[model samples]
Target: MNPKWWKESIVYQIYPISFMDSNGDGKGDLRGIISKLDYLQELGVDVIWVCPIYKSPNHDNGYDISDYCDIMKEFGTMDDFDRLLQNMHARGMKLMMDLVLNHTSHEHPWFVESRASKDNPKRDFYIWRKGKNGGPPNNWESYFSGSVWELDPQTDEYYLHLYSKYQPDLNWDNPAVIDKLHEMVHWWLKKGVDGFRFDAIAHIVKKEGYPDAHNPSGATTVRAYDMFSNLENVHTLLQNLYDKVLFHYDIMTVGETSGLGPEQALDYVGDGRRELNMTFQFEHMNLDAASPGSGRWDVVPWKLTDLKQIISNWQTVLHGRGWNANYLCNHDQPRSVSRFGNDLYYRIPSAKMLATFIHMLEGTPYIYQGEEIGMTNIALESIDDYRDVETLNYYEEKRQQGVPEEEIMSAIHRKSRDNARTPMQWEDAHEGGFTTGTPWLRVNSNYAEINAANAVKDPDSIYHYYKKLIELRKKHKVIVYGEYGLLLPDHPEIYAYIRTLEDQRLLVILNFFDKEPVFELPADMKQGGMQLLLSNYQAPKNDDLTQLKLRPYEARIYLQQLEGK
Candidate 1:
């Protein structure tokens, strides 16, 4: 297999709205990101993926882009964006923008024209269907919890919106739409941006016939995924996209596939498939889902086995076919330390443990902004403070359904997207050193002790741990390009794997539980002098390899010095 740069690159994700606020305008802007380039460089990141900074109505934050060509005024002007790109490039970093082709804000010129009159040339740009029984076009429920179909009185037709009503899903079946998308891709690539993180990309194609879904067990709203997930045309459309645009660019592309796995995902990102460089699968991230197939916004207890299996499956399956984008937290999810580690009690140690668990795997590692600071989830006591559209909608619906405010609050505490959208903690200040005045969103209450300034200076901070983890990945190409083979697959409590390249073998052993566990060496790893390369608990010593033992959350990486290499 040919060596892929992304396969060994450590990508950092920046939530532009929360990364930093350069102007005292209380919102993070492009200049803020520019000023922080050195900081990011010091963190050892090669590629940076910024969330949408495109013009929008803030309905779904910046995801509901109104103009793909213009920058959001709140973020900065096009000049600021240009300066940011130059600065990032000068520092040897590549920039990847969020490409949201799934939907667009209704205020967009194309959408406005489409909605102006049914006979407009742009009307076919969006999906507009007539009502079947004097109601919505279909029973599909939006991802944000209402009817996915929105009535457009102007055209007397219902438009599809997998997300918010203000955002209409584009009709990908149209060739015109594909042409425009290709133009947009080239526009950014020509402007010097490296690539894109395709947003909700799996929702590109809908199930034909638009069948009614099987009603959710406990919820009143129907899940549209049941009707549209992994639809037949999805692969066909993706192949067309690859042949038309993505294949022509020398840039990285990762799809935000909400419902795909190694099997179904191979066609999209399989080796040399010309579809995408990689795809972000949410299988591991959704381990703590309150219900198996339900979209309940509550976090249930998750075991280490759940995480281990999710990672093992992707790593094993993607060893040769496709590639996995390894991550713990993103803009839509809570902090890793809070979700996977014991943040309150074992903050530093657990953060390091979690970092070692993911970074030392066989894929590209994406470090979310503030993740290096050992950031934890926000504990919002009142629902009024939540700013996400989905959270607000859920709160209102839960209220009307007589589900007590307390129950709703509990769910929000566990699953609200706002929990991860808080401002980045720069230092211990009035606004957690994120902004001068009131921030666009509230800062986490614990930011006083968990800020970038503090973490970067502390020797034992999670930031340093992340630095070491990334340095290891960049230094050892095998960690990224090697084949992954899980060891002790049935060892109830331990998560262990070996990544091997030609003549070079590395072993990662992790004790996920609090109790100490012994990991017997596999037959292949028994005969060699092993040197400890890295460890989350303690750096391994040359003599400590006679059958490995790991303490609670202890993760270690060993270099097997083969005798015949």
Candidate 2:
């Protein structure tokens, strides 16, 4: 496979609101990020993806943008952002900005005009429909639940909002809207950004009729996802945008796709087809569910095979035809340590194991803020401690639905947005060194024990493990472009894979369980002369290769230099 710069790079995602606070304003800003460029450089990451810093109402934690051209005052001025971009480039790193084009805050000028009289030209810029029988336009449901259409007092019509009522979905069917979005893309590209991380990119198109779905969850309202995502015309719109504005610019465009299958992913990211470089799929992230229905977020024990299958499936499917955005945790989810692996028992080893697991595979790896230090989910004592809009909404919704407080707390404990949105634990200080004053969100209680300051100093820390992983990917092209083959498909706890290009071959072997496992080399794996290059655990010299003993969560990287016969 031909190599692209992003193909061989690792992206580090910074939830700017929680990363670092230089001014002690209890909020992380651009100056704070500027001061930490050296820290990111040490991590060996190639790209820094900053979540939305655009002007916002903060209704959905800055996802609802009021303006595409302006940076949020809390985040600092556009000049500060420019300095961050320049500093990142000076350190040989690229920058990717979060693009939230699906919806805009109601306070935005466009939305203001859109909500005016129905005959106004700007009204068509947003989805609007007449009320059905003097009620809501349709039974469409918002992602936050309830009616997707919000009544506009001015026009006496309802506007479509796939998310919060405060965020109205844009009318992408309008050519003027398309032109404006393209202008916004070019505007950022002109500022020297490497590319964009599209927010809910699949929802850009909706079924014209706004049809309702007969979902099994007893949901009488139509799923907005069905109405707005993976529509027939969505790919054509993306292809036009890619071909005209993105593909020729050498930019890295990754789409956030909610309900996409392998075939859909291929259509979006097929080799040089000009739609997207990669996409974020939620299949793996949803594996820990206990029940099959909505509001059933009890933690279910996960098998090592479950994770293996998820990763291996994407790897096999995207080996050559397309690409994937490999990740364990992002801003939208809880930390991987608490959710995916046993943090209390095998924190460090499992953290290192996950680092090896994701970074060693093909595609671009995105490391969420502070994940390298093995940050676990915060244990909130009271519901009052939670500040996330989603969590609060769910809590209130459950209460109104007659669910007991205990059950609501249980759900919150398992799947709170606060789990991933807490302030960055920079050091073992009173405020986790996140800020001098109290953070906008509470710092996790374990910050003193597990944080960036201590991890950077420790040679054997999970932070360094990730650093080394990034360095390996930068140094070896095969790790990026090599074909992926799962060597032991049915192996219960032993995960192994091979990456080969011409004569150079690399083998990755990982033991997922805590107890030691004796793993026999597969028939295809040559036993006699494989040289071990790297291991997350200590390896004994002259050890038998045929029957290898792997310590709990131990991972080894082997390289074979085959000379031409």
Candidate 3:
């Protein structure tokens, strides 16, 4: 394996607007983050990956950037950002900023200038094409619904926006656009930013021809992203990016990878490759997503075996070639404990169990903000509670299609991006101690009981447990470099894996559901030098090594042999 600081580092993601609110403006800002730098350092993370705090229209939250150089007014001035970076570096933690290069907010200067007239200097900076038969440029559907093309009456042309009309896709094929992107990146790198997490990196380069995507789902517009995502030119663009800017800086680059399978992932991220340090894979999360023969809106219940299979596949496939970013949840996904574990019944142990499921894997683990506190998904009373554009758009589209409100809400509750965007639960006080005033989004009602203040006070809390887990990664090279092998691939309720490196062996077993699962030691693991390294239970009793019983949502990490031998 190629040795790198990123490989041994633990990354923590902070969704800025929800991380902490320094002022009473109801939104989390850079000052708020600065206030919590020590808390994050104490959490033992080596890097802090803050989601876009760039100037945005908030159409898609901070993902839709309006300016590359400026900070959003709500997030404070550039000076505040400078302080945050300084605080992180002083704490021995690196800072990674979000780089949304593939698209920009409609209000961005480039888009504004491009939309002015067809012959404008920046006209080709964005993807703009004349309407075909008075409709959109193509039949491609926007991720937020409707057609991907939005018509500009002044120019009488349609601009491509894969996400939302407020966010126009940049024309990566244009030379000037590529030059501008390089300048922006170099500008940030020179500003002392450690690295960047390129957003929608896979969708940057579209196929050469503006082809109409087939309506695979028989929807009003084409929803298949094949015509635009993971295209042949994306690799070229990334490599070019690496050469133009990334090569100069000693920085980490993790792409927000999508629309690609496990094998295709290697071309973007591998040892000695110039493209990226790592990329987030969706196959593990997509196991609960729409599968073959399922409807477009279908959300399936993931089988534990399938989740283990996909993760193990990545681990084995990318073992020595590329690095994987192990995560069970993120800013865009629902709470891991709520989705994969029994959140309502066994929230604490299940949260710890879920953390073990990913944290101990043979990859760099990312702990999403608030995930360490066992935060459950928000149970909103109505649609008005959600602020995510995608969630609201999907709801309106479904409602107009005669879908029942309750059914739509059920899906929204299960998959809404806002679930993870809820303000951090700092204390048991009102607004979850996130803000002095009302929060931008509703805090999870359970925060009164699941706040960080309470967790910090409890020695065995999930917060302390995660701290230990991260510290373990710092101490155990075996966890980072050891080869991974699934122990119970076929087990439906237990996630068992063993990591081996020369003379060291580590066993990780997590009971996913809220029912006790009998975890008998496998025949191959009968050798008895196992010392329990960590357990979620208050008191772990291991009378018989061969025949072991695990409580509901129990998680245990065992050191296979004693220290020296």
Candidate 4:
């Protein structure tokens, strides 16, 4: 196994716009993060993944970059960012910046020059094509749920944007564009940045001829957009980036890969292949996603076996040849505690149980901000409270189709990205101690009951529980290099797995629901020598490793040594 610092490190994701607001601008900024270094150090994270603070129009909340080199004024100056980076390094923490290369905002200087005239030197910097039969260039639609092509009145041609109309897709065919991206990367590496998280990189390469996808229903769906990702040159582009920039520095690069399965993963993240260190797989996240030919509006019921299969498949396949990025929630998804656990009654236990299940796997685990404090999803009283472009667009379109506003809000509560973007609950004061000014987004109303100030004071709070788990990963090489084997794969409520390294073994069992279920310990682990390493409950009922009845959201980790050891 690769024994690099990155492999051993635990990453904490910070949605910069919502983390903390210093100077009372009602927004999170670089200085706000600087003030919380001690808190992160106490949490035992080795790395911090800060979302984009680059100059942007915020059409997609910083995903739409206007200037890659300058810091967003709302987020503080470039000097403030430099101070944040230096302070983190001084505290023995690494910082990874988010890299959004798929597209650029319409306000970007490059796109401005490109759209100025048909023969402008930068015209080919973006994808522009003539209309086909007086309609769009093809039947392809943007991921935001409309035609992919946006008509340009000045040039009489349409430009492609996979996300929003204001964010135009870059034409990778232009060598100048490629050269410029490489130069920018080298510039950042020279500044002593740790690494980058490549955003939506799978869509950088498009299929040739831009053929129409063969969908009979003509409904807007993920499959329509999936057809544009993981194209023929995807690997070539990554390998070139590796040769040009990544090989020279000891940096970690993880791609936000979509539309990639086990077969394609080996090519993108294979060891010694000069590509990426790891990539976030979407298959597990898609478990709650709709079934075939359906959109995100149609939420589905998933089985325990279904989730286990996807997790086990990736763990086994990527064990030898590559690595995986372990996570349950992030900036673009709902809170893991609310989505996967029972947040109403057993929020704390279920949060810790979920943590034990994911952190013990053979990968680097990531904790989103506020996750350690057991944050739950908030119900926005009205659509006006949400700042996400996706949610607003979804509400507008679904309303036009005769969907009730209440039904749309129900789905939004279940799936909107805003659920994860609420201001951090630092203390029980107004605005959850996030800012002195009115927050850019609404703070969750339950912050008074679930704020960090209370958690830090309580010895048994979820925050402390997470700190113990992070410390275990740092001390036990077994957790980082162990072989993974899923146990009781068909079990309905108990999620169980075993991690093995020669003479050492760790068995992790988590009750996924809020009900007692009898779990018969596997016969192989029934031997009397095993030690109870940890449990979520103060005292576990399963004293002996025989037939055991688990309480609601119970988590147990038992350790066993081989005969010779």
Separately for all candidates shown, the number of backbone clashes (residues 3 or more apart, or on different chains) is 0, 0, 0, 0
| TM of each candidate vs. truth | 0.96, 0.96, 0.97, 0.98
What lDDT would each prediction earn against the true structure?
0.83, 0.84, 0.87, 0.89
Which stretches of model 2 miss by more than 4 angstroms?
215-218, 222-224, 290-299, 540-542, 562-565
| Model 4 clashing residue pairs (backbone) | none
Off by over 4 Å in 1: 215-221, 538-549
At residue 364, candidate 4 shows an lDDT of 88
State the weakest 10-residue window (summed lDDT) of model 4.
218-227
Instruction: For residues 252-312, write the lDDT of model 1, one tens digit per residue.
Output: 8898887777877787788766677888888887788877666748667887777777788
Better of 3 and 4 by TM-score: 4
Candidate with better lDDT, 3 vs 4 = 4
Residues 1-565, model 4: lDDT tens digits: 6588898999999999999999898999999999999999999999999999999989898999999999999999989988999999999999999998889999999999999999999999999999888787887877777888899999999999999999999988888999999998888888889999999898998878777777688664325665678877878888998998889999978999876777688788888778899999988787876775355566887677889999999999998789989999999989999989989999999999998987899988999999999998988989999999988999998999999989999999998899999999999998999999999999999999999999999989999999989888888788898999999898889889988888888888889998898878888776647777778899876576577889999998887786766
In TM-score terms, candidate 4 sits at 0.98
Clashing pairs in 1: none
Best by lDDT: 4
Model 3 alpha-carbon drift over 4 Å, by segment: 216-218, 290-297, 562-565
- Report the lDDT tens digits of candidate 2 across residue range 1-565: 8778888888999999999998888999999999999999988888999999999988888899999999998899999999999999999999999998889999889989877787777898999988887778777777777788898888788998888999899999899999999999988898899999999888988887876666666655755566677787888999988877886688898999977766679889998677998999887776776744243255676666776787788888888899889998988888887776668988998888878888888889999998889988887878899987778878887899899998888878778878988999889997899899878989988888999999999998999888888888877877888788887777788888888777777788888778777767666556336877677775554356678888878888877765661
Q: State which candidate, 2 or 4, has the greater lDDT.
A: 4
Q: How good is model 1 by TM-score?
A: 0.96
